[model samples]
Target: MNLINKKVTHKRFGMGSIVKQNDSIVEINFATDNKKFVYPDVFGEHLELHDASIAHSLHQIIQEKVLEQKEEEMKKEEEIKLQRKYQELRLGHEKLMRNHKLHPESQMVFWCDAEEQNSSLSEWKIFSGEIKSGNNKGKPNKPIRLHQNSAVLLTAVEPGRPEEDRRILGVYMVKDGFIGKLCEDGYIPAHSEYRLQLTEQESDQMLFWNYYVNEKFPQKQTWNTGKYRYFDNSWMAQILRDIVALKNDTREQEQAQQFFDHHCKMNQLIEQDLPKPNGSLMRA
Candidate 1:
């Protein structure tokens, strides 16, 4: 038997050991480290097994690794699916663009990381370098310090609520992680105003301090941050997401309106000078 490096769990031996090996079946000595038991016929020959102190620990590491692998695989699969979906969506929009009757200014929404790999539109340009996803990292995929307005621009806005609708429509990507919907398309108005919701609790007090510290506010932490109770990351994340949405909505709308005004003025000037169909006397 060639099961020298095979790691195994022993009820009696505890953890550690390598397969000394034998002819009939297989013999595994589990008395390498605090463990003391011999297992046979479990792991086959030609396998390498290591010793573990806690039987569960060895299993735990294996399980964790397995879960990690599974998560990575799932992420890759999702990326593939997302790529396909966006491609299909892009083709659909291209088809729509070909139809003269279809208005091109419809606004829509979609999500993005700092990377443009998953953009819904062809024009999407995501942020690069450490701000996006890093080549190497302290924290995994850490987002860089973001400007309030720029952050809003990076935020995705879809035809419907992202929570309810999986497929957002009509948004286009521009340079530097900037994306917005066209007027004729399903676009969300971008704004950058936010409202804070806090309560008088200990944990809330801590959060207040966290926010203040983050904002460089020298304000003292109140009893709220100390006593505040929150369910978990999800609840608070939702609030943050909402605030970001509101802020972006305000900013984009203002910008969109400005464009409208400029366009309207230019159109009016052109129409005034252009020859009228009648060309007779159709002045107001």
Candidate 2:
């Protein structure tokens, strides 16, 4: 191939430009602090040219690459914007749900957890009771009014991770309503029990919880009083809307994957052109 001044990805050195070439050897300058010379015929196996659109002066190619990166960033920003918009719409719907009176038999419950163990929805279980009247007192004692098959949605905090890492864990159908009773051990306090059964078909794993907290439901104080928190219809409706948005963003997600794959290919070409510690060319 005609290798003079071409942008290529090296299997070892990452992205680089073919600065010079002779009858037997091709010279490449990598993005990293390395340069290499390789046999013209052998170089083809180890290096792949970038998109033909980048076939310009190194300076021009760099500029084009920067523009491409900016475009990708803009796409991500648009996704966030859409997420915020849907979140707002969900909140509004929630308010409407709250204003309307619910049937006396059914009530909605909100559940929150730190998810330190990264437990999946299937793994979650109904605990027997909580620690009684101590610093470790469990979820608050609110009136249990949920009917069988009532809705239960979960949100989780990702411990030691960024706030963005926090997400909605998904919805669970209450197989059994709150069965309030004291534990056999008096030291362990009584708690209202509910069997949270997962409905995988209706859940969204991509909806973030922190986004809702920051943009939709801002709280005045730290509200971590054990794993479960309760909310009414408005909050549940908002979560369902978020799920719908996530499911519908399939096209954007596919585009993102394509962008990421292109980036990886570029890096690999540059890396393949890197020189070894002994100042020898890496083998194809």
Candidate 3:
């Protein structure tokens, strides 16, 4: 119902809400800087649902900045931590070199297929009473914000669109009072999500890929020239190949990997999802 902090999420908006409802999109404030943003998209799953306490903690981490007087305190703590980590790495590297470890230069590099999402768990599971089987039921009647002076949690997705795939992640009470839900923690098919936090750049890549893939496919029966004109573009083709790889169909891993291999190579996976929006297709 409400978000106490400002967080970057995979939605059109980046901040969280304190009092949220279907029509109360204007009630949100971003923890990033105490600024406010409101829009039509805010009515959707602005954040994922998990636990309320964790969500509150995440909010505190984002909205509550370290005070100027506390800066030196944190700085000193960070300096000690860096010194320990650096020493550990240095000692390990020395041991490897001294022992004639044959590790390849390329082997030292790391590759992570997963992106990050920012999410939390819930304390209070808020929901609306059952609606008539066929009525619109309209939206929630209240501000949709939960009162949690305790722990909280939330869920979120990575920034990726049609062409790209992203995994979600969730965290615990990383900060303090947070409650979360998409449309007040209740939607037709809303699911509890876990999120992985990522940089803005990574988030941009995800959004770009999602748009490219969705516009080209849009969950249709097939991909055809009538629906997507850009599929014929060479750059699009190249990007897919560069970031995705192939695996045997029966030797499956996960949907994300499968998609990466298919379109990331040939854009073969989503061809069927693209169709004429008018619903006049051969299959139909």
Report the number of the highest-lDDT candidate. 2
Model 3 misplaced regions, further than 4 Å:
1-199, 208-255, 259-284
> If scored against the real structure, what TM-score would every candidate get?
0.26, 0.32, 0.17
| Model 2 stretches with alpha carbons more than 4 Å out | 1-120, 128-131, 134-143, 162-165, 176-221, 248-284
| Ten-residue stretch with the least lDDT total in model 3 | 102-111
Error of 1 at 143 (Å): 34
Where's the lowest-lDDT run of ten residues in candidate 2?
275-284
lDDT of 3 by residue, 33-151 (tens): 33333533332246532455655664554443335437878889999999999999677656643444211110000012232111112231322333333554644422122211111
What local distance difference test score does each model get? 0.32, 0.45, 0.32
Give the total clashing residue pairs for model 2.
15
Point out the higher-scoring one by lDDT: 1 or 3. Answer: 1
The clash numbers for all candidates, in the given order, read: 54, 15, 53
- How far is 259's C-alpha from truth in model 1 (Å)? 15
Q: Give the lDDT of residue 158 in candidate 2.
A: 46
